[model samples]
Target: MCHSQDRTPSEVGRDLVQWFLENQRDLPWRRDYSPYGVWVSEIMLQQTQVAAVVPYYLRWMKRFPDVPSLAAATEDEVLLYWEGLGYYSRARNLLKAARLVMERFGGRVPDTEADLRVLPGVGPYTASAILSLAYNRDVPVVDGNVERVAARLLDLDVSAKSPEGRREVLRAATQWLVPGKARFYNQALMELGAVICTPAHPKCLACPVAARCLALRHGTVENRPVRSPRPRWEELRVAIGVLRENGKIYIQKRPEGGLFAGLWEFPGGKALEAETPRVALVREMEEELGVRVKIVDKIGVVRHAYTRFRVTLHAYRCVPDPPGQIVRPRACAAWKWVRPSELDLFAFPAANRRLIQALRKAADAGS
Candidate 1:
């Protein structure tokens, strides 16, 4: 295997920049570059495809145009814009970071790497990306695509998931970064990886840096940049209760600092072993809302797959029992009752979204 020293950094930089200028995709974030736009796009791009994030990013920019605008918006309003984008913590952290930027940095995004790192959800990769891409700093970014391209180019033997492998890839990327041209060079590297050096069936022939890629010479381009095995998927059975009273459905805000944080959902929880869906719904509603409910009928089931787990949601139509008490927030942060037509004002998880649609349809049919 050849080391990164085999190829000259200047040569790689020139080729990459030239290729990028000629062949970069016309993305919205690339046009009229702003630090806020770069930060938001970077967060949204995490674990989400480019095609999916494009429209969402456009909508977010329109609604929350600047850091002050984002900080001024409510959490519910922010999540409403980010409803379908999974990994909701990114949205929440963006809100936190925007507020911090307003208070700490005087409403302007921090330009220095150190200050940027201290912002919520702004890690090393994200910090480097914002500094280099938005501010044109001489910093290196080693995202998944960059790591894969660098590993193949340097023919690193270790998996990118390992610390040693990550360091080596970052070193290679840093060495190749063109001084005073980080904005273009980093984007070029990522663009090259996305279009040519893909994980499967990489188009090495079309790659601009094919001549400098060590894996190509070693006949191991496809096998380079190995990753560790993914975690096993855990199956969960959840019971969601659609409790209604006076033409309003009951919903609760999830607690902060966990999965689906700050989003709204039907009152429910994971079913215990051997517990029936009906029993689980009753227990969960009582525990979450502090109100007793009787199952009126079974609604429908919705299945959703998260990054690490798959859940089967059993939904049921329920009504508050006699001597209905004021719903209290026991397990959640807040509780509310809203008409089916008003659900769009709040953000809900994908599974709960399906349930909401079902409820709306049922209400319409009954009417």
Candidate 2:
């Protein structure tokens, strides 16, 4: 029973599960009840769209089908498969979780939500998701969609924008979860939000429980998920592009620390105060690659967000002027010039992929 004096969660839970059976999407993870499969899908789903995750999930499942397989895979190989999927930390955490499962649980994923949370990178939401979706356990799994749906249902005024506000919403959502049938119930609410109960112009008429929805009844569905105004993000001047020659693009592998480490990337860095992009590029190349480059044409710019900072990467196609032997100076592990066709052999950041695309276009135009 829900501790809150509101309506019993059991009835709501039953309605949701009943609705889900008739409207659930045929996701790959749902086809099987393997905890490893569910865990991989959940991790891949974090900060990634479902449409985008489909191929990656399928490829990853084929490559590393189980916890033991994932545990046996090298980090480089795992990152190769995970290329273009931002937030490299999630991939690293997946490996850590697999290793933990192999060593402690004899390569078996734990079924209980509490036990699942103890694994590296397994949070409250992820643990609950795995427990309910994979193991058919009763646990409150509140993701963004679930949060939005729950917020609209209860007409919660608390800010879901801030970190603390989001936490508060999680607590409220957990209070409304029905014990012992959380699997289908949680999935149903999530599905409803993903399809009909969208962020804007929700199909209230098609909602299963629209007649009982507090937001719809009160005409506040659009604004029910309240939040404080976002702070102005600090801007960064970034440099990114390929150093090219003879159909080979120069790339350097980042060190095993910081963002996108142990991954191949275009040689670029942040511009210091009042520094020109060319100056920054030259300095960064010298510092990171121990080589000199002659700036060519400005390729383009890519706008990206990383944590708290908003960055505008100024891309430029350049050529190594000095043509010196590449050296891995400062925070770099290795350097190489690889053809575009073989780029998949190494893991690269999204920005690097964009750089490669731009370089290929340049090569085609030059030809």
The candidate that achieves the highest TM-score relative to the unseen native structure = 1
Residue-by-residue lDDT tens digits, candidate 1, 176-228: 88999999999999998899999999999999989878889988888888767
Candidate 2 least-lDDT 10 residues: 1-10
Q: At residue 336, give the lDDT of candidate 1.
A: 86
What is the Cα-based lDDT of residue 89 in candidate 1?
Answer: 87
- Model 2, 65-105: lDDT tens per residue? 99989999999899989987788989988998899988889
Error of 2 at 102 (Å): 1.3
Candidate 2, residue 274: lDDT: 89
lDDT of 1 at 9: 87
Give the Cα lDDT of each candidate. Answer: 0.90, 0.80
TM agreement with the true structure for every prediction:
0.93, 0.89
Could you tell me how far off, in angstroms, the CA of residue 115 lies in candidate 2 after the best superposition? 3.3
